[model samples]
Each structure stands twice: as structure tokens, then as C-alpha cells.
Target: MTKQSSTDEQGDSQSGSARSWWLKGLALCGFLAAIGVGYYFFADQLSLKAIAEKESALQEYRQAHPVLVYVLAFGLYAMVTGLSLPGAVPLSLAYGWFFDLVPAIILVSFASTTGATIAFLVSRYLLRDIVKSKFGERLSTFEESLESEGPFYLFTLRLIPAVPFFVLNIVMGLTPIRVVTFWWVSQLGMLAGTIVYVYAGHTVPSITELAEQGASGILSRQLIIAFIVLGTFPLVVKYAMKRWKGTDARN
Candidate 1:
């Protein structure tokens, strides 16, 4: 009877492992399919140049079907960002042009953070082991930073463009940070940058004009103010950390 029970337990374990592998494979296929569709079908449509050409048409469509346009825009923004594609900036600018500032900001913030969290989850569940296997030594530094600094390290990364946003999402996924922490930190950190992009879209006469001015045009007084905030954010974080540590020591 004992030998028979041991054989059954081993069979069950093997079956469970096989099931897990199948699920992971399915998920990887779905992810790749989404990426392929986004790249081939949607990438060009999301470009500023494409939007520039259809500006009048888009404006007309928005005016005719305001609610539908808003819903579609939000979904598209979320999907594009979730896939870590290249259309996020164009989408942001387009939203600002189509919608009012407050609406634009709200939509962009929630959609972006939501999409980022999706990417984070995907990395954590699907790609974490593969990534760790390949880059374990290099990734140890990030793991240590996340372990010691917790959400602050993530917050700083979100606030500053030091790391590409998508890369940060993927890297953070491999860490021990809670999903809720990742969501809120991403939402708040990306808020300022979102405002800048949306505001630029709102103010620009046309996408063509924005393209021509490029980074040069974006560096106006407002952008300089944003830079100042970015520069001082680290000092503020340092001060807060020091105070927190002092309090801990006292306890």
C-alpha cells in the first residue's frame, strides 16, 4: 500500500508540472500574437505622421462620436502601452489634441499605469525566469536596490526618465515589489511627464509643427520648470529617507 501511494503521488506531481508548462506556453503564444498584430496592423496608424494626415478627419470623427472616440482612444492607448510598443507618445499627443486637458490627463494617467502594470505582470509570470537566467549577475544590482529602497527606487525611476519606461516595468516585475505599489508609483511618477506631453499636444497647431520643432520646441519655460522639479526630486527623496531612518533608529 505505501509503495502504491508513492507511485500515485509521483504521477500527480508530473501531471501538475506538465499542466503548468502548457499554460505558460499558451500565454507566451498569446503575448507574441498580440505583439505581432500591434506591430503590423496598428503601428503606422498610431504614428504622428499618420495622425497629421488625418487630423481633419479625426477631429470630425471625434466631434460626431465623442463617447465612442474616447472609449476607443483609451483602449488603444492601454493596448499599445501594455504591449510595450512605440506608439505611446503619438497616442498621448493625439489624446490631448482630441480631448480637453483634464480629461486627457486622466485618461493618459490611468491607461498608462494600467498598461505598465500588465507588462510588469507579464514579465513577472512569463519572462522572469528566462531573464534571470541570462542576466542574473547584472540584475542582482536592481534586486538589491529594490530590496533596500523598496518603492522609492521605483518611484524615482518613474519620475525620472533615467530608464526607459517599458524596461523599468519589466525589470520591476522581476523584483519583490507589490503590484499595488507598482501601480500607484507608476501612476504618480508618470503624471508629470504625461502632463507635459498632453499640454504640448494641446498647444501645438499641428502634428507637423510639433515634429518640426521636436525636442527644441518642447524645451519651453514649462519644460524648464519640469526639469527643475526633476533635479530636486532626488534631494527630496534623500531627505525623506534620512528622516525615516532616524525615526527607525530611535525606535
Candidate 2:
């Protein structure tokens, strides 16, 4: 190649490589920031008593400061989710009880989706290269499948009980799914659980009962059942779709 042509080609390659590295750096920064914030907020875990206390005060505070409460609560919910913390589920249900399922589900769904997207972006940016390097061969088949079935695969994992959702959130980040795709899919996928939890909150007769249920272990059986049902619904939907398609073909 001529010197001029070779230099031009080298410049293009360098620019492309630099852009890739920049993306990697941004993702790493986000991931680390999330981890740091997670540790900061959740470092000294609150006791059930503390939860109960907060629950009782929630009503009075809401009554007293409606506007600030709404803004603060929504932002707090987003931050907790973005950081992949534990208490977001309960808070969603509380919204259901306090306002209603429609608003609660809408709010939490949007917030959670945004948070998951943030988490996903972080994973893709910072960890994808490392994960690909280590797990390339094993992940190759999975990656190919992801091109076709990634959304449903991700949806199933989201629906499944006992999966640490935050782990899934970040793990998904390293996948090939685009961030916009992840956001919409996650919003829809998480809607059912948000509905269930928010509905549960509406059933709570009193704020006191709501507080008691979380700790007294009363809600566990109910939540377990709900999760089991939630987890199975997608499987049922998938099967019905297949059965219907097969029947159509036969006809």
C-alpha cells in the first residue's frame, strides 16, 4: 500500500479502537459508581423494626408533605433500583397501597426499567470484554442464541423466583441486546411482578399491617405463591403460543 493510503487506513483503525476504549471506560466508571453507592446505602442494613418505623411514619409524612414526598420517593426508588438494592419491591407495594396499582405499577415500572438499563449499560461498557475473554467459547453458542431468543431468555430469568434480580440486571448488560431494547423489554417483563406487589399493597388493610406483614413472615407464604404463579405465567404463555401455532399449521 502507498504511504498516504496506509496512513489513512491506520488513522481510521485508531479512531475506531479509541471509540471502543472510550465506551469501555465509561461503562467501568458507571459500574463502579453503582457498586459504591450500593455499599453506601445498604452498608448498615436496617432492621425490621426500622422498616416498621418507617412504614408507620410514611402515612403521616405523606399527608403532611405530599409534593415533596412524591418527588423524593420516586427519585429514591430510582436510585435504589439503579444501585441494585433490595428494598425496592416493598416500596413498590407501598405505592400501590398508598395511591393505587395503576399509578404504582406505572411509576415503578418506568423507574425499574430505567435503572435496569443503567445497570445494563454499565455491564456492556465495563465488563463485556472481560466476560467475553474468559467465557468466549462457552458464551459463543449462547451469544448466537441471544441474537434470536435473548429477550424471552432474559424475560424467563426475570420471572423466575430466587434469582437475584440485580445480578441478572448487570449480567444482561454484557449481552448483545441494545439498551433501548433492554429498557422496553425489562419494563414489560417486570410489570407483572410490579402489579402483583402493588396489588398486594392494596390488600394491606392498614399501614401497620403492611409493616407487620413484611417481618412477621405473614407475607412470605403469599409472596412465595405469587412468585410461583408469576414465574409460571410466561411458560404457560409460551406453550399456548406454540400450541396455537401448531394447530394453525395443521389446519
Candidate 3:
């Protein structure tokens, strides 16, 4: 009777697991479908050149429907980032072009972080259980390491534009890092890059103006120096932290 009961329990557990798996699969499919629809409608309009071409139209629309435009932009930015879509760079640049620097930074910073958190949560919900079940023992040490150094690792990746933000969001979700930590680290890590890209966007018209005046070379050098400083700031901070720790150890 005891053996039969154990077998019955196992069967029930397996059935539940199968049901949950199918549900999650359906949800994923729905998400992908939504993303496909969004891409079809908005992909072309998201390009830099397209945005530039439509700038006047956009400005007119914004003036005609200021509140609606702001809401739409925020929602679209959040959704794009949450879905891990390909147009974030252009979107960020557009923010710079359309809004004041401070407002653009504020909006993009919060919107991007919020979108990332949403992706992280979705990844955790859809994948964490299965991943843990399949690789529980193997992942134990990795989970511990993430717990200890997750923010630093995340910060490094955020600072480096080589790693896509959406990729980071999904991958980090599979780990044991807290959502709050992820949000704050990502906010700070991505700030410099965001500023650089947005500033570039803000300067685009100026670039054209400068080029017309034959001063493009001077502007180019300044922009290059700014980008270099932004790119190296993280590495400098990391080295300083390491050196500080070494000095403490020696003492």
C-alpha cells in the first residue's frame, strides 16, 4: 500500500509538471506572436534614418497630442526593452532628439530599467524551475557565486556595450540575484552608455551644421574623446577597487 501510494504521488507530480510546462509554452508563444506583430508595424520606423526623415511629422504629432505621444513613447520603449527587441539604441537616440537632456535621461533610465525587470521576471517564471530541476547540483556553486558577485558581474556587462542589454536581462533572470539589485546595478551600469548615445543623438543636427561650416573635424575629435572616457570609466573603477582590496589585505 505504501509503495502504491508513493507511485501515485509521483504520477500526480509528473502530471502537474506537464500541465505547467504546456501553460508556460503557450504563454511564450503568445509573447513571440506579439513581438512579431510589433516588429512588423514598427521596425522600419525605428531606424535612425527613418526617424530623421519623420522628425518633422513626429514633432507635429507631439504638439497635437502631447500627452498621448508621451504615453505611447514610454509604453513602446518599455515594451521594446522588455521584449528584448533590437531597436533600443535607436529608441534611446530618439529620446535625445525629441526631449531635453535631463528629461530624456530620466525617462530612458526608468523605462529601460523597468523593462529589464519585466524581462527578468518573465525569464525567471518561465525557465527557472526547469533549469533548476535539470541541473540542480551543477548549478549550486554557480548560484552561490552569483549571490556573492552578481551585481559586480552585471555592472561590468552593463558597462560594456558589446553585451546586449536584453541578453543580460534574460541571462541574469536565470540566476539567484535579487530583482532590486539587478535594477539598481543595471541603471548605474548603463547610465554612461546611455548618456553617450543620447548625447550623440542630440548632437546629430549639430554635426550636420558643423560639417556645413567645415568644422566637423573638431566636433569629431571631441566626441571621440568623450566616448573614450565613458568606455574606460568602468575599467578604471574596477582597477581601483581591486587595488584597494589588495592594500587592505596587506595591512
Candidate 4:
């Protein structure tokens, strides 16, 4: 009876997993479609040409429709993560040019975390269980190693900025890390890169003409360096704490 019950449970789990994957596939298709449509509609606005022509107009739209702006920000972050897009970092630099540091940092942090979490969910929903069941014996070794210090590795991957955020998300999702842990660790881990990008965005001028006309003051090199330091503050604090702990151990 116990063996029969175990079999029933496994069957139910597999069925639910199949249903989830079907839903995930549909969602993936919809998300890709939306991204393409969005690019088509907003291409002109985000282009350098539009930046040259309608700076104040775009600024006004952003100010008046702050919520809409954030959604666009979220979509941009998610697409970059999902598709492993190449221009994400440069776009981060654009954030500083268009928005103040506070808004830029807040938007990027939330947008990146949300996008990464979505990638994690998408990966787990579509592939994790199937992959595990198919190669359970072979994959267990990989899972065992990553489970021990997954958060640390994740943080390092985020700092490098070379590792695609979505790639990390899907790869980590395939491991044994808990979703709750993934969300919080990813939030903290990604903050460094996000702030770097936001600071870069802080200096971007919306209109080349204004910059050329001497209407906009680009941040001095000194100021940019200072902003970069400010963004690294949390990591600095963590290092200080660790060093202090080491001294205490010696005492």
C-alpha cells in the first residue's frame, strides 16, 4: 500500500509539472511577442535621433507618466535579462543621463530583481523538474556542489557583470537553491551592478544639442569617480565588517 501511494504521488507530481510547463511555454511566447512589439513602438523614442529631436517632450512624458515609465523600465530590464542582450550596460549609463540618481537607482534595482526572479521562475517551471528526473543521478553532483555556497557564487557572478544575469538566473534555478533565498540574494547581489549602471545613466544627456549648446553640464571625471565610490559603499562596508571580525578573532 505504501509503495502504491508513492507511485500515485509521483504520478500526480509529474502531471502537475507538465501542466506548469505548458503554461510557461505560453507565457514565454507572449513575453517575446510583447518585447518585439514594444521595440517596434518605442524604437524611435529611445534612438539617438529622437534624443536629438525631442528631449523636453520625452522628459515631460516621463515626468507626467511616472508609472508608465517604470513599467517600460521593468520591461527593458526583463528583455535584457531574458535575451542576454549586449547593450544593457550602456543602457544603464543612459539611466543616469535621463533620471536623477535616486530614481535611476531605485528603478534599476527593482527592475533587475524582478526580471531575474522572472527568469528563475521561467527556468524552473519549464526545465528544472524535467531535467532533474531525466538525469537525476548525473546532475546530483552539480546540485550538491552549488547548494553549499550558491549565494556567494551568485554575488560574484553579479559583480563581474560579464555573466549574463538571465543566464545566471536560469542556471541557478536548475540547481537546488530555494526560491526565497534566490530572490533576496539576487536582490542584494545585483545591487552593485545596478548602482554602477544607474550612476552611468546619471551622466547621459537626453539631447545632444543641449550638450553641444552648453546647456547641460556633463559630470566632471572627479564627480563620476565620486559617484562610483558611493555606489560601492555597501560592498565596502561588508569588507570592513569582515576585516574587523578577523581582528577580533586574533585578539
TM-score of each candidate structure, all chains considered together? 0.91, 0.74, 0.81, 0.64
Clashing residue pairs, candidate 4?
93-201, 95-201, 96-201, 96-202, 97-201, 97-204
TM-score of 4: 0.64
Output the lDDT of residue 148, model 2. 62
Worst 10 residues of 1 by lDDT: 210-219
Tens digits of lDDT, candidate 2, 39-102: 6776443233344556757778888998887677677677777777777766776677776667
Better of 1 and 2 by lDDT: 1
Model 4 CA RMSD to the hidden true structure, in angstroms: 5.9
Q: Name the runs in model 4 displaced over 4 angstroms.
A: 1-28, 31-54, 82-86, 127-145, 205-251
Residues 1-251 of candidate 1 have per-residue lDDT tens digits of: 69999999999999999999999989988998999989999888887778878878888998899999888888888898889999898888878867899999999999999899999999899888876786677578888988887777877888777878888888778888889999998898888789888887887767776666665755678767876886677779878988999999999
Each model's number of backbone clashes?
0, 0, 0, 6
lDDT of 3 by residue, 1-251 (tens): 69999999999999999998899999888877877988888888776667767677888898999888878888888998988777888788778768778878878888888899988888788756655676566456546766766577678778876656765676677887888998999899888888876776666653233223432423476678888898787789889988998999999
Output the lDDT of residue 197, model 4.
55
Q: Which ten residues in a row have the lowest lDDT in candidate 3?
A: 206-215
Predicted structure 4: clash tally: 6
Alpha-carbon deviation at 89 in model 3, angstroms: 1.4
